[model samples]
Target: MLDFHTLAEFSRANCVSICAFLVPANLLATVLTIILTALHRPLHQIWQAAGFASIFALIMVMHVYSWFAIGVVMLPTYILLWLAITCLLANLIAILWRRRFVNTPSLSNNA
Candidate 1:
């Protein structure tokens, strides 16, 4: 099992590869989930849970107590981030369609 420092060093050495791309992407997904939740979207609980899991992993890593293989840790992060972003986009599109076409009045409908 690698210590956090060792893992950090390894990640730094390969920063241009997967770690560099994923860390920012995960963080961005977390932020997007939080934003969507704040807006009272459909992904409230799922986003909260995924965000909590990521935060827990990040805290564990920061404290040097994380023991999972890097791939093990990263794979779930990627999956959850992708899921959250996809759900958020779908919810946004649904809301926009409802507001523009379903809820709002149109001249054609009046005619």
Candidate 2:
């Protein structure tokens, strides 16, 4: 397993290349999913929300890890990471709750 410091150094060294790949890839996939869902309205909503939550959580985790790797261990970073984790867990719970109990027909009719 690579340490945080090593990962940070690698990220700094290949910042441009990493951004070029990660940013565009994430954007493209999100756009494609949105487009597909818009076109196919009957697609399950839970799947979409779950996918989004998972992606968001992954991004937050990556950010926290990167901050640790970059030698910027400070109070603000700690707070931000704590918030991110909390939000991620909340979103995950929401997704699970909606999956288990929320009815799509009732929600659609209500809306």
Candidate 3:
């Protein structure tokens, strides 16, 4: 269906199309997660987590392709995905450390 000259080109075109939409959708959700996590907004954390899970599901579905096609389509896309995941992980670690350090149990209870 795509306007490509060869079968390989057609497959790459399909991959590019799928990844094109997936990349930005993932990024926006990640940014939202970061903001929500940073502002201590737990209200939407569940929903955002679902969104993140869905993105991964989509990526896994895309992984059905052969390595050759993947190599063609997943250059900058995977890089961006890795960066987003790293940011999310860092945010989660920061949040955990903040809670632990800020709300420590009193060492010496004045009995």
Candidate 4:
């Protein structure tokens, strides 16, 4: 099958370039998410931020997986991944909560 070791080596070699974009993107997305949450903004806005963060997180995880493939275990990677997952879950729960409990009028009263 797939030669993960080779892939790991390749990723490791390019870690700097990969992280350059991911780090800033993740930071901006997370910051926006936090701001939206603090402001009590609409669920859709929060979702947008969380969605972007989650996407970046997934990409970062691939880089972390490369380290694992190469037999390099880093605690920071686990922490970062956990944070990413938590943020995504929080956003999802907010959306679900709004959809489930917040009632919207199905029809207008006036003709």
How does each model score on TM-score?
0.33, 0.47, 0.46, 0.62
TM-score of 1: 0.33
- Write out the backbone clash pairs for model 1: none
Per-residue lDDT of model 3, residues 1-111, tens digit only: 753246445545586675666666655665665566566555346345536645653553443243335464556655644655654564455456445544566577644
lDDT of 1 by residue, 1-111 (tens): 758677666654554574455456556655555455455555445445455545534533432222243434566545544554554454455444434544457598787
Candidate 3 has a TM-score of 0.46
User: Model 4 clash tally?
Assistant: 0
User: Which portions of model 2 miss their true places by more than 4 Å?
Assistant: 1-43, 102-111
Which residue runs of candidate 1 sit more than 4 Å off their true CA positions? Answer: 42-111
Return the candidate ranking by TM-score, descending. Answer: 4, 2, 3, 1
Model 4 alpha-carbon drift over 4 Å, by segment: 1-10, 75-111
Q: How many clashes in each candidate?
A: 0, 0, 0, 0
lDDT of 4 by residue, 9-104 (tens): 777899888777777777777677777766667777877777877788777878877777657777866765676566566656655654554465
lDDT for position 41 in model 3: 54
Selected candidate, larger lDDT, 2 vs 3: 2
Error of 1 at 83 (Å): 22
Between candidates 1 and 4, the one scoring higher on TM-score is: 4
